[model samples]
Target: DVKVTQSSRYLVKRTGEKVFLECVQDMDHENMFWYRQDPGLGLRLIYFSYDVKMKEKGDIPEGYSVSREKKERFSLILESASTNQTSMYLCASSFGGRPGYTFGSGTRLTVV
Candidate 1:
């Protein structure tokens, strides 16, 4: 079972509210990243994990946080979302020792 699941396909939130994005992988992967996709910015890494319970900040970590309490579950949190945070959020699990990743369908967030 090699699947990466994202909790939502479309989400709408207001500025200054907290938001949560959930992801799960059934492949037992040890590494993955939360990326935000914008038209011009492309894919920007928000957070990444080395393994369970351990994480590292990526390119854009100022407004986001991640939780990897379990091997299969990872959560992205937006403490105080702003309008600029509106974008597609993707969760991808890396293949062990390989330079590949299995990506989720992505959650399109609209923060207004």
Candidate 2:
């Protein structure tokens, strides 16, 4: 079974700090994604990579960026964290065209 691991479960940061959220998958999935869960907006995709060294921006990619240097690792970067960016961040991995995905236990971030 595929297991997605997130580096941190909770995070607190100041208004202008740069935050790095890491996700790793045990299965060599071809697709990896980063999404933020907000109350009203639901789960909005921030970034995704289909293969190593390749990425495509999702609906809400303005305040974020992603790196997929290795097949099992994907990293999400917040250039400068802000209060509005505070939310539950989820990482997921799946085989392309597969029916289901494996997700990490999310990282809840708060910016003061």
TM-score of 2: 0.96
Runs in model 2 with CA error above 4 Å? none
- Look at candidate 1 and tell me the lDDT of residue 95: 61
- Residues 49-93, candidate 2: write the lDDT tens digits: 999999999999998989899999999999999999999999999
Model 2 clash tally, residue pairs: 0
* Residue pairs in collision within model 2: none
Query: What tens digits encode model 1's per-residue C-alpha lDDT throughout 3-87?
Result: 9999999999999999999999999888988999999889999999979999999999998999999989999999999998999
- lDDT (Cα, 0-100) at 66 in candidate 2: 90
Clashes of 1: 0
Each candidate structure's TM-score, on Cα atoms with residue i matched to residue i, is 0.96, 0.96
lDDT of 2 at 34: 96
Cα lDDT computed for each candidate against the true fold: 0.94, 0.94
Question: Which stretches in model 1 have alpha-carbon errors above 4 Å?
Answer: none
Candidate 1 clashing pairs, residues 3+ apart or interchain: none
